[model samples]
Target: MHLRRERSRKLIETFKASLTSFACEACGVDMEAIYGPLGAGYIEAHHRIPVAQLEPGQTTRLADLAAVCANCHRILHRNGLMSVEDLAAHLRARRGWPLAAEPRPEDWQGPDKG
Candidate 1:
């Protein structure tokens, strides 16, 4: 079935709004964290089930999508059929570390000075 552009766009907006921070769901890489102000609010929505594999008349659910950074998105496309959990595990293994600790208030270097 052909997915409507408007529907896809709406899904992406909804997903972004639902997230606390616009970070890659898989590896937790925030665009703003890496690129500073330039990367604010940047993320790509990935269909959990590849659109190409959807059967005719099938419905798309919000749960069927995830917000990913460009790097993760590209890896997903290149590797094909890999789940978000798979990529997260690969990243953790590649880095030889578990998820990093959350930034402390004193450790923050953003422009907000109060």
Candidate 2:
């Protein structure tokens, strides 16, 4: 159990460190842009596959994680682990925006760059 916790922690840290921008994957909320220096590189990781649902001996990779803001994270959990794509769609629909194709992470240059 201890080893599992340590591995999980390291994986999350590595995943966060891999990001070039800490913007929320679902809503594009850039914490640094919104809160300045204090929020630089700030983001919470969400499991694409809920941890509770993982099969025994299953492993998680960085690609299995999504960076999300606090509100979006809460909404995801509250809504039964709704997918990141689904949440983004819901937000777009709520704002009366068209559902355009989402850019891949590597192609996304963050809000300021675009």
Candidate 3:
């Protein structure tokens, strides 16, 4: 039973990764964009439906999942019951940022190119 659940989880994660953008869905933070090549392909997959609410043998839909960076994912789970959208909204409001702010080149400068 446990093995089956684990395998199903993996399958869902794989499917989400294939369909979703490599950037964090909530903040659009791509690993490579921030951490450079070493961070490429590094992201966390979040299940939209809390695992506790899922019943055995229930079907997990791709839409019910999200790809997020570590920081955003952590914030999503901080209160133990925060939705992705809620977290995103809270962050945006607090930071006074646009919902889908694009990263500016000047925003990600490497060490002084002097």
Q: Per-residue lDDT for 1-114 in model 3, tens only?
A: 697679767876677558535777766667776677798888777888876688877866777778788888888888786888887777666655565334333444466622
State the RMSD for candidate 1: 4.3
Question: Per-residue lDDT of 12-111 in model 2, one digit per residue for the tens?
Answer: 9999989987878777767666667898888999999987678999988899999998989999999878999999888767654443233333333456
Clashes of each: 0, 0, 0
Best model number under TM-score: 2
lDDT string, candidate 1, 1-114, tens digits: 134767778877887788776767777777777577899999898999976678876756889988888888889878966888888788767764355223233333457644
Give residue 59's error in model 2 in angstroms. Answer: 0.6
Stretches of candidate 1 exceeding 4 Å from the true structure: 1-3, 100-114
lDDT of each: 0.74, 0.79, 0.71
lDDT pick, better of 1 and 2: 2
* 2 or 3, greater by TM-score: 2
lDDT of 3: 0.71
The C-alpha RMSD in Å for every predicted model, in order, reads: 4.3, 5.6, 2.8
What is the lDDT ranking, best to worst? 2, 1, 3
What order do candidates take by TM-score, descending?
A: 2, 1, 3
